[model samples]
Target: MVHPIKVQLNDLMVKREEFEADVSLRSERLDAAGVGLHGSLLDKEGYPRADIDIMSIRTDRKRIAELTNDHKSVTNQIEKLIQELHAATKDSKPSHDRPSAPAASTTDKPPEQSNGIAAPVPAGRPVHAAQYSRPLAVVDGVSEASPASRAGIQVGDALVSLGGASWESGTISLQQIAAAVQASEGKEVPAIVLRQGETVSLKLTPERWAGQGLLGCHLRPIGDTTRG
Candidate 1:
């Protein structure tokens, strides 16, 4: 079944593409008029440049400026939508299902230092949980009978956090994810994702399977998605 979040995402993608196409049209119009986007409208003596169609370029420039501003507004709207989607997802989940950050320990014992001092837990997810788990990567492909598949991570899901490698300060790299999985080895590592707009937390134990990668999934940078 098509997830509502995925449906909304598809609609947004189509809208962004239309915006891109509109911007492209304006660019093409400028090119055809033999004028640069920021080319001086006036000649050396502060007179209007007669070589190019100044009047037409001026009109195009105004439209381009308007479109640019509108595009930013659209982008902000998209950001807000994603935030709300994730927030709703988190809120909707049961308390027991709410996954903890990397700082959390799954053991029965309290997490502590060698001297038995209680370890400090970061107030919240270092990456800012309020970001609604901004996606680190998109699951492009998932092998059947693989750990990722077993964990319920589907191919169109957006990976928000995996094990100890969620993003913070800057973007999280694929290598970091690999390292986190490798370190976990046979242990159960928490996996968080947005599947069809619903936040689903999973446990993925990276062990030997008849698959190629640790999770048997392809993760590409955010926005470079294959599935709608």
Candidate 2:
């Protein structure tokens, strides 16, 4: 019989795959509507496009959100299962087999001499654990005629930092980037991204264009499975 933990892992994997497939379907619908993955299905004037079914797209987006939540829940369950397995293994050791205390230190010895050696110093200031950077967001799709397209931004690029704010995997949201874009108005914003195996810097400008949104691209948070 398969181990219970293994079975749970398998189930989680299956759920993740199903989530990915659902996201793919949603993306296809967006593409059919002539929009990028997260791109608004609207016009330059902020009006819904006449060529696409807005209600249908809204429904698909809602379903995508539900699937995303389900995936996260399954992932958390898998993590808990793994932790339990680890704890069980540690508990399996016999109490008598545990290492005995070290023999009492030999006769109390005098304090060791400094030997003229200075204590080691840290290289830099300690950073808070919460300050670490994580996968912020990923470029899902880019409009062919948009400013982002003109700036050489492509789909699948993982955005690490934009303007002066850094994105952490679960701490930051796409709305932060949107706010930055709006604040920039029509000016160029410096952005750092991880593309493939290399890091690249680009200047992205958000302005009125022929598409719905200013940037003309779709951005999804890194925590979401719709990264493609």
Candidate 3:
């Protein structure tokens, strides 16, 4: 799901409008100032005053150009995001309420997923104690029987530990620890698996499965057991 808070289309639109307004107002003021300065130079008949006035005008023009570019860039970004938002919420109107900055809800999506590691929890309904459990970690795959499958590790097994480390389900940042698995390729990473009413230890090396290398297991939270 796309997070609306991290890069809010509405907020970007507001900023774009503000910048465009600033550019228009500043440009008009600049033109008026140029006309007034010209009249002053004509009356003064002084080279020093004319040079200073011209330099100041040039500086103002440059600043205006920079701001105009910024406005245009922001406008384009807003347009693109509007298209994306429309696609995501098709047939439904999006909430116009602006989310807070550093949108905790929107910006929390994982950058990438690899090595069977999960990303930080995205915004979702809170998991109650009844719906929590150990997530199963797969450590190896092989040509014959996958280690997890051979050991009867199914999709819903809660992973209880990794090399005896306490497995905190639902909150593991899979993106953060993918490197460790890549580095441990061919080496057995001891995994503590929690299957139906039982937990067992297994050491297995990573192997390719379904295109990407995996230990071939899924995890459920401890709360999943008590959930109706």
Question: Model 1: per-residue lDDT, tens digit, 115-190?
Answer: 5533322322233233334677876556789888887777567786776455532335777667778888787876
RMSD value for candidate 3: 20.0
Prediction 3 global C-alpha lDDT: 0.46
lDDT of 2 by residue, 28-141 (tens): 887887764587777899988898888888888888889889877875665466456545544766767644333444322212226532111121222222222354766655
lDDT: worst 10-residue window of model 2 = 118-127
The C-alpha stretches of model 1 lying farther than 4 A from their native spots are 1-9, 94-228
What's the count of clashing pairs in each model shown? 0, 0, 16
- Candidate 1, number of clashes: 0
Best by TM-score: 1
For model 3, what is the alpha-carbon lDDT of residue 35? 50
Evaluation by TM-score, superior candidate among 1 and 2: 1
Q: Kindly state the number of residue pairs that clash in model 2.
A: 0
Q: With candidate 1 superimposed using the best TM-score fit, by how many Å does residue 13's alpha carbon deviate from the native?
A: 3.2
- Itemize residue pairs with steric clashes in candidate 1: none
**Deviation of model 1 at 17, angstroms:** 1.7
